[model samples]
Target chain A: MSLDDLYQSIILDHNRRPRNQGPLEGADREVHGHNPLCGDQVTIRLKMDGTTITDVRFEGSGCAISRASASMMTSAVKGRTTAQALTLFDNFHELVTGAPPAGTKLDGNAGTPGMSNASGESTDVKMPRELAAFAGVARFPLRVKCASMAWHALREALVG
Target chain B: MHRSDFPLLAASPGLHYLDSAATTQKPAVVLDAMREFYETSNANPHRGAYELSGRATDRYQAARERVARFFGLGDPDCLIFTRGTTEALNLVAQAWGRRELEPRDEVVITAMDHHANFVPWQQIAIATGARLRICELTPDGRLDMDHMRELIGPRTRVVAFPHVSNALGTVNPVADIVALARDAGALTVCDGAQAAPHMPVHFDTLGVDLYAFSGHKICGPMGIGGLLGRRTVLESLPPWQHGGDMIQVVQDEFSSWNVLPHKFEAGTPNVADAVGLAAAVEYVDGIGLDTILAHERHLLALATDRLAAMDGLTIYGPPAAERSGVLSFTMADVHPHDLATILDADGVCIRAGHHCAQPLMRRLHVPATARASFYLYNDESDVDALMRGLQRAAALFAVAGSASD
Candidate 1:
């Protein structure tokens, strides 16, 4: 419940200078996500090469949690294949919602056997350490939406 | 007076509640009255021939009379008991707007109106192919009287506006707006959701065709509100809802409606909550609306001066003399949600969002604002807590800024 738990140094840094921000050119997939309760909005655009996500970017206005989550998500998913990105998304979603990283070790350890994506390949991917900074958001139930806004948009863009 | 009346406030001793515009905490007397109703006269009103039903009917009728007197409505029957201001306004839009409005007719509303007043008219206009005209606000966020004078014309069938802007706290010129609507041969529906809590509302004196106010905003229970309309106007509009209580005769193919207020109230009305609202009315009257208004004005003035002194802070709405107890503001670097969360850490509760007035937020060019609205229970100490909360949030963001450098 402490503010420090939710607004860690990493979150504030990402929010202050968000990485991979603004619009992407010739994006093959684009999606918008909004949390109507607090008016947090994010538009995610992706440039895909076959199943690989070559580049990703986001643009919008929101609270520190939302902006920082989007920045970390773009940095995590860049240069990864679509299936790996989806797996990372699943791991990140679990991390923020108070669930342990189920099938993957995101703390700089080797990956475990994970679920497979649409390509029938093992979706076990390395969880980026930076994305784990948002685990504290699970304590503040209302802010889970702020932390997951970008991931929801990324899910829609990739799966849909 | 120090939070003893409301159990929630009593439990959370250090909580600085500034979201009165959303809903006011109920007093002990209102709660007791509702409990008393259940203990003594709990029965379906106006149905059974038993003594308990008669007593229930009597209490319900008495609550209606008390509400009518509180709002200065001459005829208690002209007032309809609604779920809240939203339902009351919707009843007007459906019953009156649908029947009277035709294609090409205009329903003029201001940009300062809450969505409760704005959306219903917009939908009615769209449904009837009527033109919905939006009057602009002045630079200071007051309803632009000059713009209203121009927009209201012969074709303007209705003019619905809020007595106070929930987002900006601007106390609009109700008399002027009503005069214009009257001149154009149009009906005026005044949204009194915010106004009735902070100030005394004399519905008949306002010269409005219809006025709506919620119970929860004025220390009453939720799910109960009052809507006052002219007796002739009430008779003219058909009932928006029809069921057991609102009918006079039920035929095989056709049914006749009941008289004035009952015609609009369908099914089993919220009688216990109505009694609670009556008790709330008495509680506020005991405090004297003028005294409450003055106390709130003092708190608002102090908060406004303190907030104005802070750097990178912009306060919306008119100046202190012209506005109500609500204070909406935004800091330079902190989003309202972040600010509100930081404030909550200090037990300072303030609203942070569009205030259900998205159009007003767009007009002000802010994604959202943090609003601190005061009521009778608030004092100078509450304002001090708010100031401290703002400073803490600002300092946190300032540290974040320097860390990035």
Candidate 2:
């Protein structure tokens, strides 16, 4: 895979102008994630309105993949229910790692986020199209951690 | 100067490996020696009555002598074979630190030290109830001499520092630091992982009581390294680990430890890699460390000049004159990992991360830096490739930045 595939225009844009890049006000759940190999750190703040996440923000220093993923994560999960956010996490995990999410049977998406599976069942929680830009990360195994760092933090926040 | 000596470099003409500070590519001669040892002299040393074991014992002992001579150590007994610098340092910190340090005693290490040199002392200090004092760095990343003087005071029991900074390529003044530690009546320990490979190092003349280095960084095999220490200092410390070869005799009641180097080398040692490391030592000595140093300095100078000329790029540490072969830098708006990935696509390898020196990274005030370290195998072309890759990254980021805005 070429560099453009990993650093898609969307990724660069998100990296250049990361979205929701500060601590959420009155955050109920906050979790910090670190990639020890690359020293990429992400602190995710979520303002929970009961089960639904009303606001999400991430602040940290990371490479393009990680920072962009975190920015997109906040945008993706802001108004999502805790369960839906976890489903999205499962979908996103499969997209980058080429591995099925443990204990979560991905609906119809074949772990490809938006792509159709043989069963052709539609996933209730689909990954945002912009998040699919990280699909190429599967080819670069070392970068799977970078692409999944923020998502991992999100999962930790919601699950906890 | 001798790129062809390394088979991987010779095979892949387009590939540029700039992460030698992490581990150097071994030359053909070193590989051949290792293969020869396994093929002919593979046996457990010192246990059997067979000739092969004797041969293995001889080769392993001979390798120790060769490594000792390479470091300019007069006595081979003072050198203990370790897996790498980390193990050697841990040995000193645990064995010596535990024995000597008391509550309120101070262990001084520099901010520029790699984790191998830093964490061991920190842990030892914590375990022994001793205070760990960190010597700060100057703006250019050299050790602060005045701070060094202040840190090594009456309570200071041990002082550990790196001979060269792995992240910043800062060549520290070992003699000056040793002098301060000596005046304070503290035992001096030097981490020579970066220095042993790049330049001439005289372990005996440096006046450090203990020095640790890895073989892989010096063109030798992995899982093999050495710690050079003063014989008296090494003898005073009890064995940190107890195992097969390190014991003199095992009684039902108690056990006695083996002699100098063997007492520290617990397990059935890495004999083949030891033989291979000796071959590597011989290969490096044949090339002449002065020649290697000169060649690396030229490459460092060229890279520094070209990188400094690039827009929005910052080079860390002292100028090229004071540094060894390492060159760490960061491009504005591009994270070091991004720079590394872009460079990887161009077949120019580099190291990007905290470099296992998170304290130093905190000191530098950057999360991490992109490091393109050169070695004897590298030449002007590698630097050209690195520059080209940086330009490409800059161009891509510029377009992306404007489009996003």
Candidate 3:
């Protein structure tokens, strides 16, 4: 799909029932993120195994890009190993930052190795290429924080 | 749309300014008054004794008298000129909070207070080794009266909060809250920042021991505001800031402070801003706060109606009738920043973020929101313009991800 179509889908899905609209019961982890100027918040919850992400969910509220982004993130990162998830995180950041594909986006980074989940969805999708829908967020400098809120919350849960 | 008298209404032509809650547009009269001061009466009043000096003093003191009466204050001497609400609050925290409280004593403040009112008392409490108590508001934005009564006992020394919440637009029951604290033997401090510009806040009638307001938000010049202390409260508290024009005697070993208002005003105060504020107060008073409030309320109601009617709009703050002009919201899938940017393109300005109330945001369970705040300058046209902007923003987002479609 074109960049525009990708963005439309993201918004459509986000506007529908948002992923993790409310908190999960008996969840392993929960962390909060907020933007102080306009008062938006989101909390992240992750159920992880020894070396694999067992289940990933988000429970919170925010604008379209953020809520939808969290939904997409939950979809994209689940069942992936920690190292692969980190690479996807890096690619997502690079995509929003508009970095050249010469490094990560262009290469068959996921296919050359065993980067698929139990469902066999390739972990090698350089999210920047697919997630390029959020590039418009980069055009508006202030919205960058909205896109980053979930990512930041997720990073805290994992690295900690 | 824009008030003709306000220069900043269309200051950046086609600029949709939604940050009035932060500050407001300055009217031409306020600007002229300030310019008139600098051009004609540049002499320092109260300190200098010349022709121009006397003229300056006359106008300056007259402005003070005007503000005193505006808030139902009888004596201008009871009014202390400060930088703005922040400074006014800090002065009280230092002069009263420090001098009065014991190490284990407590000061009760709501969770919704702006940092200006919240932090000063916190610092003062820290300095005095006094404790700072939090009186969290209920989910619906009212002060928890039961919690308040439970909190303010003998150990509690003062109760401070905003008359209207800057974030929630909650018009707290000031008289009731003040009475509660007063009966508990505690001083009452009310930050009038959010309330003063939107409504007629009578300091004397509010019965708050100390009332603070900034001039800028009320279409006055920046850097000038006042603190109205009860006559008895003014008499008990020592002036916090010390310098020229605030001293009765300056001996080699020690110095004695001057009386009342001047004692609180140190150095060369914001004289020009004071003149502008006075002019602003006169303008609001002349227009009748009834009209200003009625107009703003109408605009707020119109905006909220249009927004709440939208397919995916979720709004924050009080109900349209209960809240003032501030309307915070988020579209179904559009982040507030994205909404604001798209709105900006449509020549509508708005503020997107936490609005300086992080705690309130946590309670609302959302990060950042698009806030279309109305003011005296905003009219029905602006509200309609915002409605159009929202439609445009939704349309823009609707077509965003079509990479190849």
Candidate 4:
């Protein structure tokens, strides 16, 4: 609702110095996404070995929210499998769009729908704490697109 | 002008509305006229045989006449009521562009035009297999007339440009462009959406084949605008939309069109909004367009000086003397969306985006810019509020950086 809530220190730091900010060599897939409304654009590249994402990177020019989201997404999904990365993307998207986590009781799923932790406990129906910084985006409807721009490209890069 | 004359401004006291280039706040007189029309004559014009319908028809036609006189058109019938400038431009593209353009023909448009003026021509060119050529802008955002001259050749079928840029507020050289188009035997379509509200527009003297302007940008109701064209040119083109009221006689398979303006207008028109637009025209005329232009220029000068004095701020567009009432700028390391959000918290409304001119954004090498536009209602205090809001955003960002460090 306020600027402080949306522009958290974590978001600003990632925007200032994004991780994996450039191209990924010998990538398996590369996809581009752009928000025509604000002219924010991101190109996401991925390197997949079998069903596992070995590396991921992105490059673009946009607002702090979009840049930070892209930087955070690349860092979160780099070492995870394709399936795990996609699930994480879904959880992050829901967190920013104000939707309940996917495959939760509210989503009418019989079983939890996320990856297991080291203790073999199901961590479904909860967004990773790192992505909680973006929860404020839901209040500013116009900025939801900024938070989701990179994830959209990631979805396309993985699926298509 | 007293802000109390506008109901919305009166209700939202201390609200700084700097987005008038996007749409102006409506005056009480225009609102009252529209309400009175609905209360007194609610019948469908040119439909019923009763006196109410006759009165409605008279009122609608009288609106057309008033709009014509406001734009300096001799024949009211040459002006056709439309949904807005976008629809008017689309009408020209579909009706005129489809018929006149052919394969290998060129339709020249500028890089600074709003999407309403750019996209319709681009679509028409694609449909007809004609080439869509774009005129570039100078480094300072003015239209590159030399490049425009080079682009307008014998194959150019039409030249469409904006009278004033919605994004950069660059006042184009209309007479020169019109003369070049005429010499090249190309029809000229001037998108006057930004011009009519800020200055006096004479459609006939401009020598354009067609001119389009919206009502909402001129302090009138939305969903209404006017397209002024020469009688011969309007009659030559086929009807863009086919429906009731635009047909003279219809068989099971064939139909003949109506007269000049009516042929372009299909179905029941926006009668109430048209009446509101007429009232808007009268209201501005009462204040004198020249005076409004001067007031806006003064505001623009004051705002430009203040913005220029700011650290790490870059203002877009030509100088104040050459432009209208728009001021687009960018602050150091701060996105326009962030600036707009900060300004909104202080009750200052501004537009921060490509302003529907993405091509110009690319030309400027910026993703987007924050724009503050002035109108009749905006004064010096509004500009001061904008500056204060921007300063607050800068201070916040600076503090956040230092805290993180």
In model 1, the Cα lDDT at residue A95 comes to: 78
What's model 1's lDDT at B314?
98
Model 4 superposed RMSD (Cα):
2.7
- TM-score, each model? 0.97, 0.96, 0.77, 0.94
Instruction: Return the TM-score for chain B, candidate 1.
Output: 0.99
- The local distance difference test score of model 1 is 0.90
CAPRI-style docking class of model 4 based on DockQ: medium
lDDT of each: 0.90, 0.90, 0.78, 0.89
Tens-place lDDT per residue, model 1, B1-405, is 436878888888899999998999989899999999999999999999999999999999999999999998989999899999999999999999889999989999989889999999999999999999999988889888888898999999999999988998899888998888999999999999999988889988889999999999999999999789999998999999889899999999999999989999999989999999999999999898999889988999999999999999999999987788899999998999999999999999999988989898889999899999998888888999999999999999899989998
Give chain B TM-scores in order.
Answer: 0.99, 0.99, 0.95, 0.99
Model 2 regions lying over 4 Å from their true place: A106-123
Tell me how far the alpha carbon of residue B33 in candidate 1 is from the true structure, in angstroms, after superposition.
Answer: 0.9
Model 2 lDDT, full chain set: 0.90
At residue B188, candidate 4 shows an lDDT of 95
Alpha carbon lDDT at B261, candidate 1: 90
Q: Kindly indicate the candidate among 1 and 4 with the higher lDDT.
A: 1
Specify the highest-DockQ model's number: 2
lDDT of 4 by residue, A25-117 (tens): 898899999998888899999998876779999999888899999999998887776556666776776788877454422223212555454
Clashing pairs in 1: none
- Writing each residue's lDDT as its tens digit, candidate 3 over B275-339 gives 89999999888888878778878888888888888988987766778887678787876777667
Worst 10-residue lDDT window for candidate 3 chain A reads A100-109
Model 1: fnat (fraction of native contacts)? 0.72
In candidate 4, the residue pairs with backbone N, CA or C atoms under 3 Å apart (3 or more residues apart, or in different chains) clash, namely: none
